[model samples]
Target: MTDTIEFASYIVERLKQTGVKQVFGVPGDYNLEFLDYIEKDPVLNWVGNANELNAAYAADGYARIKGGLAVLVTTFGVGELSALCGVAGSLSERLPVLHIVGAPSTRMQRSRALLHHTLNTPSSFTAFTDMSKQLSCSMALLNQVSPDTPNGYVDAFDETLRQCLTQCRPGYVELPMDAVRAVVSTRGLNVPLPDSHAAPSLEALRQLTPPGTPSPINKLYKDFGFFEPKPDEVTEHVVKIITRLYEGAQRPIVLVDACAARFGMGPIIRHLVEACGIRFFTTPMGKGILDEHHPLYGGCYAGRNSLQPVRDEVEASDFVLYVGSLKSDFNSGSFSVHIDDAHAVKLHSYTTQVGYAEFPTTDIRHVLPLLVGALEGVKSERPRVLGESLEQKMKQGRVATLVNRPEGTDIVHKWLWPRVGSWFHDNDIIVTETGTSSFGLLPVPLPSHASYNAQVLWGSIGWSVGATLGAALAAEEEPDKRRTVLFVGDGSLQLTVQEIGTMVRRGLHPYLFVLNNDGYEIERQIHGATAQYNNIQMYDHQLLLPFLAGKNPATPFESHVVRTQDELHALLLDDKFNVPDRIRLIEVVMPRGDAPEPLLLQARLTAEANSGH
Candidate 1:
């Protein structure tokens, strides 16, 4: 039998080669040996979280930060089971997570016996993959599968991991104690790296057709479209649009998203943004590339919850330049209306295949820079600021309307948001959840450098916590960048709160604002009646008990439970709470009647539509 240490070493080394720097988990009886090996290995940093769920979430965060393969180790039975929640989150977001699990000895495979923390049998852990894959990008394992493997461990683990990696999804793996002891030399292992797969070729690109344009990939080289002809077909076409934009436009803007980064268009994006001399706002996922503090930075375009000034800027722009954007809900303000006045030119991989209902051109990824190049000789006469400061006046009017509700100690959603916005700086990233908090305050206002990130397209409630961890990691990578902040409601926070310990263990100091309004306020608002079943049992609002509890207990976290506006004001003004190692939970005692307006409107609209309204 080979030494288990070698196997551990191989796995750890391969993980490192894949750019994995941290592993999230807790020790358990079945995985004790592996944990021992981890303790001995200096290269692999094992983060001991308060629970398996948080550890799993931490892995999600690390994977997001590291951007390719992320590893999370857990023991058999309950340890593996506890992590399913976070794994489910990873699946929903299409994030890749290598869940390495330690199983009981192979000799005990068929032993029909109950074990501690197991439900009747020890096979429950493998069953989770079936559900996990449905939510994640994909799932699989590194190990080869074989028939006669009880509980279908091979199929469950291998398939899940393979799909996650190949499809750019999340995956899982369970290592039997015997397998950990098996002899496997590291010399031949093929560890993968980010973007290892080649991108689509020029041939494939040419094959793509513009919306309503019959120019297929094969026809691209056939026609000398840009050849020595008058007006240079492509150049003329680009100039006509540019000339029109220059003559008609006022307050031009460019909006970019993560797709730009994915396409390696950083330099081009910067050039276009600079050339246009218009303000730019990136989605939370698309932050960092553009310095938010720049005068032309318009702050995050989505999820400010009625931050009027930002919305006004976006809506008033005469021309909106979109680069590599997929137009997901988060980037689109949960499908809220804005930028109605501007002509939009969207750029993306599939721009040519489908026409945008709202814009003049599609498939701009290539056309954009081409347009910029063609406009090289053309003078820019785009207006500086449009309509005699009309945009600014409109923004102030909207802000006034939001904060003007009649007096009551009850905290209005609009009023609550400004506090968070007021605290923000240019470099902070805000990770939002998919409930009332994200939608109620329609027009979001952010510091020039601040941005909002959420899975608005997916609208997953529990995604914010794990996503925040990933965002924090992204923020930390930038030199001297402001810390990432999470504006999570109580109900959503509980779903993924386990990651808090993982954050602390990894030394990520993101300030988590747990808006403890006591229930799933969004659902209740829409339903107009408390769905008692949907409401979760309350937990300590301030103290993070989950992080404090370990194999050996540690002191409970010092938390503040605020219940009024006065308390929040005092807390925000206080410096101690802002300091590291201290978590203050401001419990704004909002009325149980507090409901997100959009949810209520949506429910009303649904009912009306059902009645054939």
Candidate 2:
């Protein structure tokens, strides 16, 4: 006889099996039943957030650090719709997030009952699912509670989860209220969920090796050796063309981008760089994907906004190998990049383009290792002439020079970001918001093993607050327990500031840096320099912390406000504040017009483009 378990319990069990330790969302009437299963599950905890949107953002952040699916549970229409923006952001960034909606019962839907959360129309039952279809890779609606249809439900759930893993995108599942406690076979739990593609070489290895023979394939099989499956003939042919271009070039350089992190190709790309000894640079979105401390590490390259030496090296290259590259306007300094397509080899998550040839289904994760292996014997003749390393330039105290101004001078962009870089330690996870904070970090030198997080492509403003909460949780789970730091604008903070309470509630302590620049300074740079629309209501940030830390808070938190250069400098050096025993918030006040150098340049370029110049 097959064992059985509650359907909701099975869902929670599958989530735990996939390495989800916590579920983030708000409890609602529709989802309360499913929330009970989450709470009672010994292995999983329900992380209640201030709102549905913040919960979704937290899930996205968690997915980024955890390198797996992050699950969020919400009620039917109202709660799920509120969280849609965050879900769309995840979809845009290719992050895997499983959005589980506790839907109404099938009986109610069959009767065409006007649900409180629904649109109040008889035919509004599938409205939310129809809207979600655009943002999710796959979806499953489990409305059947009959015991005989358990296999169908299981198959639907399994396939949706599979699509989420394979595509690295969001998936949706709607579980009716009546089905939450319905009985389902527990036999599916006996088999582990398929995690990745089956090793393609397994069948070949068996065929090439006899039953008693000690062949290389047998040795590899015995040792559990794994090779990324070989590419198809067309892919191999494209790789050969790229090999010829790369080998024949005099000065070749590698450009790394955000897709490296998205597809978990960081280690492979790092190995390629170290083994080949080729000079490499990261785009703004791909900043922390590679070790910046390496000698061959050139500074960030962003079209004309890049440092003079970095731009010269990139534009002058005879051949450009762009691995996991994303050429967004912001990433490319408003489409200012000047490389010819004939001289560039672009590698993406699922495709590879070499000169005029394009090969579909040519995954970067598979081709990168083979490309590295091919270049093992070949050596590049290009000299490392990408100018002074960022580390070397920072040692001269470039930002410190600006710090010598009068004591009461407000902190400016020229001195702030680089100074913050000096405070970063190895193994720190820094998350920057999508305004001046993101652009300012382009020039800062990150230490070895330090990871940077940003929503560059999505350009979400208030994402950092909720993301910080999730990232801090992920960092705490790490072996070394790296520190989590956040840089967000005041305008951005106002959008999702409630997540700070969630951080405190969960006992997560991260250094939260609020850039109180008066208003939307990034927008001011682009269009409105002094428009009233750009301004936001200022909050006493230091006082807001006490309110976020509710009665009988689990952890002690501290907040401070800095108005001048002297105050900011002293706070950075304070031993008690530097040691992050509890949550700390530092609000730094700056001038209204101050913005990062790169932001100003890009804003001007964007304005010129918009005006048809």
Candidate 3:
């Protein structure tokens, strides 16, 4: 018989089983015991962050790239509360994060004794978990133990993790101080955690047909009729409706969004796009979900901000297949996408919509493969070749528009992003902050196998710094050792700049590019042009590395500042800087008011919207 282990050890082993190599968090008195177990584990590493918020962001970022559950360990009350914002972002973006909070001992909780991190009220113990319910898919409070069932806490932990994986959102668990060492039977660890896929029950199959009718299972024919179809049958019918819409339309197009990656549907969607010769486009939130290098890949479609040809093709399409679309204002170019509901078929993570008809419980995972099979040999009258010129136009505008610029000319938004694009290599994960950097990098064509990370819906500034640290760690584990590239405005960088020190301490070498455009440039575009409230204090960008790196760094580091177009162009061509042996930071300065062309158009639309136009 196998020996029982401490509850903390069981939790660590379970996390490792879920593919979590690192646990990101801040150590506290409440969590110290749990941290010891995590650190001593052979398979798991403890990544100590400067703060709990950064730890949460790192965990979320790690989950985004690793494609499995990411674990974050924080202490009770203060620590868990600090990490709530990050957890909320993960929930909004559909990323799976397991947030484990170390709480006071069971005795302390039952006695209602005041604790240092507690709110000093009778309800203090349960306050965090109650608040967490709003941001997490599941929550487990393990303060009370069942006398009859010693292993009851394990069931709660298992269910919380299961919900996190199945929902692709955050989950919470509060482990009391004493329970950390509570021994539990290791029997549960013998069997692997169940996946999201559930087999159809025999009872469900019987419900699909009327009494005395032939089994619907046997009727795989095209004309199979149902007397009373179950949920699965209705989902299949919706899929067929979408398939027919695509097959019948002359000028059909596929639009992808961020949920494709969040729900692990990128490969399936790519297969559908490639197998059917249809023009493909991505919303700003969906950027990098599809390979921009694909011959049939068109430019990004952000409503009015899209290129003329891309806008024309998408808006004028006879039918549109929008997969995992999160039509937020910024993503849809201030809600300006002109596709009519009658002509579009939308697919979400858990729901599918054929025009105005909505089908709940119809997962994109089940429908995509069927859609791909139905449209394998189907060809649209609008050839995929139409996308080539549009792609070329995007590239030409970047390359030709800035060529032969005079010396001493100030760097503008137009020249900066495209210039940065030339430096991107394959297997690079590009993370952008929520301001100008987000909108600026939209048109830059990502290389094959590259990913563009942005918090478009969350719109949280300073998320990229911690996220980059997490992504770099995740990438280091990959076979090819993908590079993590970050683009953040000076204002956003100030919020989570301490993570740079964490990256240095961890020996991660992400290429950090800070856009030093004075302050809050994206916000300035949306509302305030020259308002003092929109501005922030400037810092010596070059000094950031030296200060963050400190003395006797583990790895080599490089930092540079470029103010003019010629200097920026020359830096991109420099091999030594391009192929750095360590962490590299490039601060590209641009005019205060200048922003990306698309961003400027979006700003105008946003301004008009606010004025009741």
Candidate 4:
């Protein structure tokens, strides 16, 4: 009896090891049994999202912020399917999340019964599992008939989590409703999960592919590659090559991207910039990793779609040390980056690319430190790459945009984001939606230690609203009270706006900055400038707070709409508004035609690409 526990308790215990403080989900019939365990757990809080999709996104945001495992629970078939798109985003962005799906009972599944959630066919039992398999690096659909290990569910659970960690992406597990109550050995729980598992996940995954087809794993490795250390000599050789190139170039700069943070290598990268005294810039994905006020800091780089000063300086540089770059179209300004393979040295978690040559096994963790040490003493002729510092230029631009504007004038994107930038406190979590909110925030720099959480690569609308909830919850777990903030457009917010209710119920305090430009401003910039498709029905946003926050809550919420410059300026300066206590919503009114410079540039580039020009 001492050696066993309830199946649901076992899973919760596994989660406790990952240091995840909360589990996000929408309770359905299949998952109701599991929810009982989640609700009762003292360590892990159950954050009931408005829907399955938002829960998945919340899980993603939580993992990204917490830098640990994120667990998302859902019911069978329909519930899990609804959450897949959000899970897919996490998978694509290499966020570690375990999608625990409470599935049908073993008896029901094996009997080939027409389940309520099924497609009315016996063969449809495996359909959802099959569909989900494509989205996850590894998955285990456990049942009574499933092959059992010595420890059964415990071993399977550990193995599944191990895959999620090693792959640094999403993984899936299925727990039958009856299996949630199954007795399992306590032996597996006592033994901590290993650094790597003995079981071969790729070999098992290969079986799911077509019989004669080549392994998809190989193709995946070709694309995303793998992260591992190599022989001492290979790493030394790569470091020497980078050091040589750095010494030779008149103007050398570092271009950082999202994977540095994803792989937890930001500290070493930051150390490299400081120790080597190299000027550095960040892609939208890479922002907030380094201190923006650092002397060697350059502006955010996004090919041609960057601030004019940033674009000019980056393009002029003879050498670029690209670290953890994920050059998707949106992140890379519609594939407009001019830095070629010959001029750039890329350091990835998996591999290092020097010129046109690539080393498959030299891990960035091993190589980055050595390169930093090698270049630490070297004297760079040009430490400061740009004529005018990006920070100073931002100040100048702020004056030009906001200084002379009338009190009653509408707040445009140019004036809005910079003002928002100046208002941010250190160590805040800033989440932006895929529309103008994301683009508008790019040109301005964030405060030191601020965490930027934009779904730029995935470009999922309404993502920020759900992500904000997760970020806020994750922040609550931090020793320091890190303020959470969200900037989502009026149109994008409508997609998953119900998440506000979840935020209210949880008593999470996030600053929700809704950019009210009428509709999809980014879409308007892309093609339909004045078309009806770009328009959206307006919401009385000031009432959004009271309606969403339920009656007579523990903490009060503040909501305001600012149509003019003075209104926004006054609200931002208010001490009550700055406190991270109550949830706040600010609907800042702006011009319908106005957009951030980066968005305008990318939209034009996207249109050209679509037109086959």
Candidate 5:
């Protein structure tokens, strides 16, 4: 006789099997039953978020730090709609995030009655799922028990999850209100889960191999890894072109990009870089991809927008080998990075380019390991490394000088970033907002074992606040308990600031650096510097901790306001302030128009592009 279990238990069990330990979302009438199973499971922890959007952003951040998949739950219609942008960010950023929506019962849907969260139309029931289809790699609506899927919806859930992991992108599934209580065969629980894929051996993931160790995504990002390559687009052809370029060129360098950080290519890239002993550089999106302390790391390269030494080094190279490059306007310095197809070879998750030739062959996951042997022998013959560390130059007078500063001088972008870099602690998880913080953090040198998170490609304002909560939870769970720090502007913080309360409720201690610039500074650079449209109402940021946490909170918290350069310096140098024992919010006031150099450069290029130049 086959054993049986509720559908909700099966979903919870499958999630547990996939290595996910926590579920994030706000409880709604539709999802309350399912949340029960999550809470009851000893292994699964339910993180009740302030809102659905914040939940999705939290899920995205969690996926990034865990280096794998994450789970998000939501109620149908209103809840799911609120989360669309966050889920869209996951899709655009290529994060393996599974979004499960608790939908209305089949009976209620067939009746077509206007529900609280639904529109007054017959199509309202399916409209949300249809809208979500465009945002996810795969999706499934589980409402039946078919022979092919013996345990009702487990097989379909498993398949959709497999597709999400295979692509390392967002996925979707809808569970009806009644279906949560549907009886399914417990025997299916023993069958492998949505977590394991490709390997015939279920034990391999834990024993030796890992998941989503795919290639660095293509920096060009034209195909987004969906196109079928021609017969000539083979891996062998790419290997041939790369080997030839390396052997013939006097100066060839390795460049890593956004895909390198998301697709688990860090170790492989590092291994190849160390074995070859050649200098390497990263695109802005590719920061934290390798050990910055590595002598071979030649700071960030962004066309004319780069530092003088960095620009000189890359522009002077005879050949370039790019790994998972992303050349968006912001990432590429407004299309200023120019490279001859004949002198460069680009690698992607599912494609490879030999100069102008594109290979739609096996993805980077399969091709990258092979190159470890093919190119490890092609080290540079001459020393081409920059004379001094780019970060040191940025801090030690190249950008700003610390000496003889007026005590009341307000913090500026050029002067602030380098100082922040020096304050970074080992194993810190740095999260930067899409505005100034994102571009500004690029010049700062990260400490050993530190990881950087930025929504560079997506450029979503207010994303970092909620992301910090998820990243902090993930970091807290790690063996070393890495400290999570967030750099967000006061303007951007207004959008998703409610998550701050969520972080406090969860007892997570993250460093919140609120850059108070009075308004949307990034927007000011792009279009309206002094336009009233860019202005935002100001709030007393120093009171955020106490107000958000409520009275007599168990979580330790502190807040500070810095108006002068001297005060800022004193705070950063405080030993007690630097410790991660409590959640600290430092409100640093700055001039409204002050912005990072890269952001300014990008704004100028964008303006020219807009004017049809």
Candidate 6:
């Protein structure tokens, strides 16, 4: 119909149709033609990067925020190889990323003999293919071999891409140079893409119940050195305990963590939260599934760093329910709260296992929904606000602390949270690093998709910046009205700071706030001066310069060093710096030896022990 769009152009069209606003990668001689066409294609934005690693990282971020497949393109050889770290990370995290690599032209393959930029053999491609198989269990290979129907390449390629995305969530496809311009018969290339697979059948769900815990599952739990309770016997008991808690508490709240989304129990959990009119809040890792903006949302309920208003709400509530949430340090603020000692009921997969009780660990996907259904006749009072003024008091205290910073000082954790919170809207997304930034900045108070990626199972540093990029990419696909924000520590920033270059090159504008606390403050706080070895050599604070590339690369972003409260006060009031065309980097120097809240410390210890510490 339209002169049969070129294969590369068709790719741009299809990705655009899937709501992909941009693709991240570098241009090279092998894929010059493809890159040329992409430059002129308005439907797709080519996010060029300094290195393949950052390109992949940026794509990961974009995918996490966008909630779909993010494409990262690279030249053959080293460029392709550099993407492995990020691809591996994506696979481990279960994020969908499309890696499209450009190989030497098909016609020149015989003559190249593993030319300068080419691999000695197809082994490199084979390795990537293997990684794809291991990561997603789906694969696609194309190299312009079909002469009968040149367009068959595009059709086959598109179909495979769809399968990888819907089924596995992460995929890899390699394209040779000659195939970029392949022209195939247009007869059936225009067929609409297939729909996503249907939901699992109701009958299939019913059959999931068992007369007793399966031995394999039992063996699996035992191997983990976990004490397995009688899951089948306790399911009823736990459901009753939760139903009673709902009946007794005037203001009951349920906290769901990453388990809800990973196990696919979001719908059921939301139904229960609504049916019982209980307030709900998800840990940063569990922000999706149950939209945080929903009225039933109570916001992330951390203590000190809890959003000003939300903290008040949490303090006012008499009961806290742990549903699909492990009592990890990140969730409990480092074991700060006495969860096992608290009067709340904890409902995980199978058993209503009381706090610290030996319980059968079950998959929440099968358990939560069934558990919710089992409580149909158990009526309960709607969760109510016990103290209307509590939120107001918290808000006032937080505002005073944030708006006024001490003079001639680096940023403190407490002062930073409120200002950052002010910049975010109800639906904006946040991904925070683990260092002081994670320890200091409590989850923002707003109702948005915020993921606290600082590892809970372990205190992993340098996880947030990359994770933020991933979470942002994941959140981007939700709808038009969403933006991603990253809060990182100076120490954590050093670990993955290369991503800044990736960000600028890809034209991805995320608001990055780095807590420039001079050195490893968190480690110092924990281990004291005896941990002097934790110090890292510093670099020029502005690291975005090396990555910005284009025919006419204009440095449109701004980075400022804020020392006093006055400077922060002046900056927040200025609205012009928040535009998408520019990136605003605020480096707030903070006092050394400041530890993350004690709540986090306690939570971390509890999580460590439970995680087989």
lDDT of 2 by residue, 1-613 (tens): 3587788888888898888887889988999988988888888878899999999999989888887788989999899998999999998878889999998888888888877988876558888998998899888977643546747677778768866766678999988988788778888777666342221232322333212334433344347875533345545666778888888888787899877787777888778777777778899988988889777787789898787767887899888889878788888988888787998999875567888866555666667777888775676676635455657655655322333443447788887886788788888989999999999989776887898999888887799999998888877767887889999999999999999998988988899999999999999999989899999999989887789998877789999888887788899998888787899999999988989888989899889889999
- Displacement of residue 583 (Cα, Å) in model 4 is 1.2
Compute each candidate's TM-score over C-alphas: 0.68, 0.91, 0.92, 0.91, 0.90, 0.68
* Model 4 whole-model lDDT (C-alpha atoms): 0.81
Q: List model 1 lDDT by residue over 358-443, tens digit each.
A: 22223344555565655444556654442322224324564433345437655666556655556666666667677766654333
Give the winner by TM-score: 1 or 2.
2
- Among all windows of 10 consecutive residues in model 2, the one with the lowest summed lDDT is 196-205
Backbone clash pairs for candidate 4 read none
What's model 3's overall lDDT? 0.81
- The superposed Cα distance between candidate 3 and the true structure at residue 231, in angstroms, equals 3.5
Residue range 170-218, candidate 4, lDDT tens digits: 8899989888888888887776552211222323333333223344334
* Candidate 6 lDDT over residue span 1-613, tens digit each: 6767667777777777666777778787776787887789876767666567767666666665555567888877677777777776666554567777787765566464556674567663355455555554344567535646655677667756765454325676667788787775454446655322222332322233322345434565579998754544445565666566556666666777654543455677778866666677766455444755466776665444355566666666567766656555556554444333355655543334454443443334434666576555666555344232222344556433454554555455556665666666556666666565554544444444443344444344565565555555455445564566777777777767765655554455677777776677666654544565877776566644434333444436677777766687687677676555565577766676554453345344545556775
Candidate 6 CA-lDDT value: 0.59
- Model 5 over residues 119-164: C-alpha lDDT tens digits? 8877888889989988987888774334245554776777777767
Better of 1 and 6 by lDDT: 6
Candidate models: Cα lDDT each: 0.57, 0.81, 0.81, 0.81, 0.80, 0.59
Provide backbone clash counts, one per model: 29, 0, 0, 0, 2, 38
- Per TM-score, the best of the predicted structures is 3
Query: Model 2 misses residue 521 by how many Å?
Result: 0.8
